[model samples]
Target: MTKNRWDNGITHHDGEAREFISTYFSQTGRRVLILASAGFDLRSTAVSRAIAQTGVTCRGIFIREERPNADQALRARADKNAEQLKIVVPDSKVVFIDIFDPVDQAVVGARRLTRDVLPILAEGEPPTDIVVDASALSIGISFPLVRLLDNLYGQKPGTPNVHLFVTEDPHQDDQVKPDHAERPMWVPGCDGDAGSDLKSKSIRLWIPQLVLYRTEALRRIHDFVDATETCPILPFPARDLRRGDVLLEHYRTLLIDTWEVDPRSYIFAAEREPLDLYRTLLRIDDARQKVYGQQGGSLMVLSPIGSKLLGLGALLAALDRDFPVAYLETVSYAAQLGAMKNLEPDDWPIVHLWLSGVPYA
Candidate 1:
């Protein structure tokens, strides 16, 4: 009988997981704000350590789900954990907010929490760079915060440099329910299946794991608020504050216009595997070269081998070229071709190279 090593009690980490976390910490430098829920664990501790090692200032805002004093056991555990974290990382900043209310209520509470906490932010400092760690929050709660941030502050320029990290929980894997085996199947033309043939098409959706924003961009968003009216649905008090809907509407308009005119403003990916990164770099390079034209084109390549090849190619191609030319990877030609529905045989030759795992030439 063959034995499965992992079937026992050993925890194994994948390279992609390590790479993702490393890349996240290495990428950001500004003040970091971590938003966590009651389920915070060792992963959060690891993240805090990584940030501290990077010499970046870090603050954690933990949302408590249990009532104080009523649940002594749970409260004690929570308090002990919070205390340990403080002792371990004494210099680290931490704040706790009660969120014992229901989901909708908690969401409103969080918004109000953010508003009230804004005053606690140091005065005269440029809006501290913010990073909301939504790995712990439910999608309902997490999505709202994301929408709020995106509405208030747009992405940082150059690279979407903000690091939004989500940690996958083991419990989450068990929560996925299998499809029902007894579910009825639909076939067309049969009396019972006539209308049943109208099956809903499965739509594949991709949500970005990380969202980075420029500090200035977020400040601009907050500045638009009037601070007089109470923002409804948000836990914050009603003062003469600008409506959340109005701010969000303006944000949507700006995002759409910016994306259409400047694809550089957004870096979206179905997944962030290394392969995807390589492909994205190639695509960007190709687009830049195309826009600039052959005469004045400058190639910027991110991959090490690609960069070396580009330098050599520029020299060799420079000698007998009819037009000034540079070869680089900004965008993957494969990805572009794949997006198209059909391809001519002529195009297949190039496409074949990509499909065969050959890097862009």
Candidate 2:
């Protein structure tokens, strides 16, 4: 396994992901903190643990959102997961936090940075490094976790380095049920007339993060903007046969029919490699700023990203500069009793990781 770290702002690495995990566990004086969304992806979790040569201290911080239906399912799975973790790695501390306080959500800024999040990590000895998996999470919990991790990195410089990872294996061959959407709305990134003539300037840039569930929202954008001015960005995960062909066809029709632009040309696409997605956002923002700085009257917009790490990257980019972000918020969610079809074990190996909050002295 090879490793590559980011140069510009916050340091991030991308390499053979499994290799990183193996190397991380093998080191001495390391403590592991696994944030359990539901349960550990048994396969990946075992592989990571097996590589640890030195005896490593490990613990789990399980998440239970304030929702009733979801929490019920999560509780059952988390209990089983905790049992399994204890068996695999003895005496591991397992904690369950009841998050998603409505009042907390209503709060304007970061509510739990010092209060809830820091306290959780501060428990036990400080970790040397942290490995976070954002795969099992839906949009809501993942958003807050991403925000929390970002805040952690922003805070003390000497804090332990974080390795954020997610598994995305959209099994193309499997018959999948469509995700239920309460309403599919595609709101603009910045405040201008919704259908304002996009051709006012020769250069307008739009980067819409693509996913199967957001088909309607993407269509809404295609209808709203000149397709030539848009750069549709899709996440190419390690294993993603993300079968959004219907949505892709719909987008292709609009781009060709309306703006006469090649889908290939109006696309700034790449595979998201761990934290590099964060770097990609920074780079995209830099390019957009360069465009506007050199030539006034050019508009640039960043659309909503589905992946937690990538979403955090976009958030960081906007925080520094007034980067516009288009959003489609979900009103409700459905929780399945069993593993969801396409998102099951065959699509993915159940994954969890040991994250260290403090580097060993």
Candidate 3:
């Protein structure tokens, strides 16, 4: 088997992440290109502010989700963040790409990004490093963007390295809810040929990251996948000791009655450590491959419906294994009225992962 790319990946959290941003540009001759969300979420411009403090010469592509029935307060907040992002990265060429089609409600983010941004990355004097702030950008957008950049520039020598950044706070995530969810669909660029019937002979093992308030999304995806086996990923050693237990109880009915997931198949990964989840998934897939390699074979399908940290881990594993990432695209996210009322800005810790770059070379 080929070695896992992120077996010893570079990652930083909290103060270390801030310090890395402060010194990264000064130490290396790299021009950075940051793609982040310009949403109502407080952490939308978090990474931008960190990079600005480093005096890095970089550009940004701020994603703005277009919602028709969005709350006025939330819309105002999004607008404010966009302005703040512009102020923080004053010298950089910044662009705003609107996601979610207004008419049919079909996710056109991947298509729009390919049309508007891919050319820029391929042009002369492209950025030497690409950073994606996945804190606020929905998985529908961030996953495809990261996959595209990696396929385009990360795998080759003298090409830009791809990095993922996020501000993680499970409490904050629990407060926000996705409303008006649409039917489940395969994430663009991470489909792994799931639609083809040629793989019907292969045994399908579905891995889903469990999260609060995402029961419906999980159910939709589970029914869509109809996998032969189900392995649920839960966060352990979490900030809240009872977090994993609470999630298990919340999804007890679905796990027991609906999906019929085995208790032995539950995966416990650290909430703060993305690499832990990465290594865990790699081991499980390796064992399965060993047993089914010469047979009809086996397929691992992942559904990342949890925290951004866990989602990053699932994204990494899917990229390495070429598995399908199934997800439920939301029609519109519910406005946060008072859910984040008591939370302070510092509650969310900044997280960073350097997926590929000079360090690996």
Candidate 4:
């Protein structure tokens, strides 16, 4: 809202993303640090493969969740991805961070990152580029890391370039279902003041990213936040023209009946373009700022329960304004591995965005 630098950001898609990584990372004297998740999702290794194909060795940190109740097939797939990452980047030492508190399922991943990953970034030979594959990691895990990097390098010119990579497969995403979601709570560092301590005069705006089969989770968050205004974001100019319609119809009961969201309150942005969503959110916040600047200040709480690309957009916007992000972390998933086996690489579009660095400077 306040003169966002990434309003007109750089983004790449599909083969173009691969080409960018290959050409740019293959250059001489480039110290690249990649942080990705070791997950059962098919797109877990897409970015790593792209970087490895360029013959450019880089540091790797793969996040592993310690979920005892996880499906066997899913665990196998995550283990397989972790091994494949090692094989792909054979020259470098890949550190794995196990980020899960088995007892209470609290948000300890950020604490683990500070202990395990922060020292590496703060070393004398700091990385020149930090690439985060947001596809496999949950929003709770990825948002804090992104915020940390932004706070560390976003303001400093010629600092480490921060890049975001996400492999988007709408169909594949639809196939996987989240199960046993925890209560809605604020994400670690992005926790905005949605609690009881918030001032009574403050206007709260809730922006939720729409997706399929997340009604229950979203309902819980909506009740918790009790926002003054609701602006639900829908995917427009999507790969499928009917997606926006489908989502609106799917959520009609919740939006209209439950939340009483206005017809004119719908926000739409390109499906694969994070900057589109980023700019749209900033515009909304700009209006709030102008109207409520002299008041107690408006609070925008974001719920990104959709695509990883959209989640990245939400993270970028939150970093700029310190917007609160509320989410229900999944305790276990309910996915059928066989259902996703037939998916081809071409079906998923790999996206790469240059978030910050010398290029922008």
Candidate 5:
């Protein structure tokens, strides 16, 4: 059996990490807080250093895990890294929280910091923002933290903005050849069937941290407690418009509605499954006349065979229609002209619509 090796430095793949860091740099001058777990502490010193270099006020909350000698050594390494970070990012600050501590205590500590520590740190400074580095923690706790912050500091129409940056591990490539060259891979829709050229593939070598949010537009997120209470079916924010109706045309007229204007909006990175499915549906709707029939009537009210052919398309369209704009904002932002190809065979129809770029009803 081959022994797996673990390394403590950042690894680059697919240009994702670079893009993520660039996004933060673009948003410089905002007050930013980084909530980091042990994994992030290990993997993202470079990122932290980069943030500091931007001259933005950045703070890091490090979550420590209790362990024996070996673990202690790793913790010590992190501490050393933190110390080094202070030199590189003289303005940046750090706080350590032990995970072995009780959950209630941890929550209390986090709340006290957000409510008390952070504000004081800001010292009535103008233009403050917060970003949670939740890559290491389970979504269970991380998701709730986001909700808690929103509730504690209710978002005024245009007040001090808080940004939450939750980072996740990048997909791994286990198919390297004996020579260690990356296996040939292409994002089908992105470059089409011809396959990405060698230069594009080589430049693509950076693991991406999906920017789960666009800071300025995050109004409120449903709390974890409420989500758990409902379970299986997630509870979405209530929409003012009646079901089956299109969003008011006035919404499209807003300045933010124009392509590329707003900087402070919240954008989420949705799981590929849901986004792909939604895209497929949109494509089916777009090509309906060629594939099925006319597109005038409600796609939902079609015959059984037609509906199945459409499959999850109608359902996804309904979600986009009725749900608050935030639900699909990420899909809208990350949406490339042909980003939805290469979906699993079963998900083909839904991916087609999602890539078709049709606006939801």
Candidate 6:
């Protein structure tokens, strides 16, 4: 197997926006195009900044859920966000996607993206580099499109890379409350339904989604892995201030002092959403060889990520690298004690995937 580079770590929200464009542009020598999902929050600053700094155009596929019972204020907030993005990002067009709709329906994001979004983004630019804001999108829309676009671009001789980006501000998320009582649920999306091998000493790295509520049960991950074997490895990007984040800090303390998990486990990856973590885990020599070689080996898997892009990353790692995938789905995530719900299968609107062809290596 060839060596893969894992470029990840935390940069201050404001500082990293401009940095992402300049750095990626220089490396790839390709124009930046952000394939992002819009939300009620004004977090699109990162996307706007990248466009302003690079002067490259962007086309977006915004997934807007049709929550009929949503408060008028919520609807207004979303409207304002949509308006703000257009104003901030030059030469950008946003395609509204209602992911809950059926494939034949007019509002289905997957269909719209395939029909309207891709053609515009592809026009003029033969290889437009994609910057996906996988931080907050329904798995229904995120998965199929990512698989489609990544492969669509990957097939061409000079296939432009589909880069991943995710941003989470505990400060903003904590303003709301969620219940602490959570139940662990398993996530689907594995090839062979095999049992996890807890005896392996080889690295079984875990990419956590959000540490909002499950801070306590995280230790149980060790129960699954042998004591001699590192049960649950926690990886967090640096440049984070845990002052207000009690649960996250608590877990960090446990990882370093109580659990004796190696310092190497705490990943200093892209603060918002960087594809590096997934790429690194996918390229792991031991797991890659064992799983890819189709040897009698099982790779450990855990994902608490809230971002669908991260979820896509997890799924890709599991499917391509041959790792067994599972999730600790909370018992009830009905916006319960400020619980930051982990990503799960049911949360996503759909499970089916649509791609033009197989992904390129």
Clashes of each: 21, 11, 0, 0, 24, 19
Ranking by TM-score: 3, 4, 2, 6, 5, 1
Per-residue lDDT for 66-108 in model 6, tens only?
Answer: 4324446545656776676666565567676543344433224
Query: Better model by lDDT, 1 or 6?
Result: 6
Give the total clashing residue pairs for model 5.
Answer: 24
Ranking by lDDT: 3, 4, 2, 6, 1, 5
Off by over 4 Å in 2: 1-15, 39-54, 66-68, 71-79, 82-115, 154-156, 172-205, 217-229, 235-247, 250-265, 272-284, 294-301, 304-326, 329-361
Task: List the candidate 1 regions with Cα displacement exceeding 4 Å.
Answer: 1-30, 38-42, 66-73, 88-94, 100-107, 120-124, 127-129, 156-161, 172-361
State the lDDT of candidate 4 residue by residue for 219-315, as single tens digits. Answer: 8988877789999999888989999999999998999988899999999988988888988898888998889979877888999989778888888
RMSD vs true structure, all candidates: 24.3, 7.4, 2.0, 2.2, 22.1, 9.4
Clash pairs, candidate 3, are: none
lDDT, candidate 4, equals 0.81
Q: Which regions of candidate 3 are displaced past 4 Å?
A: 92-98, 122-124, 341-348
Q: At residue 185, give the lDDT of candidate 4.
A: 80
- lDDT of candidate 2? 0.47
Greater-TM-score candidate between 1 and 3: 3
lDDT (0 to 1) per candidate: 0.31, 0.47, 0.82, 0.81, 0.31, 0.46
**lDDT at residue 211 of model 4 (Cα atoms):** 93
Candidate 4: where are CA atoms >4 Å away? 91-100, 122-125, 193-200, 341-348
If scored against the real structure, what TM-score would every candidate get? 0.37, 0.62, 0.94, 0.93, 0.37, 0.56
Best by lDDT: 3
TM value for model 2: 0.62
Report the lDDT of model 5 for residue 299. 25
lDDT of 3 by residue, 86-184 (tens): 888764444455556777766777888778777766554677778889999888788898888788766578877778899977887787888745678
lDDT of 3 at 251: 90
Query: Cα deviation of 26 in candidate 6 (Å)?
Result: 11
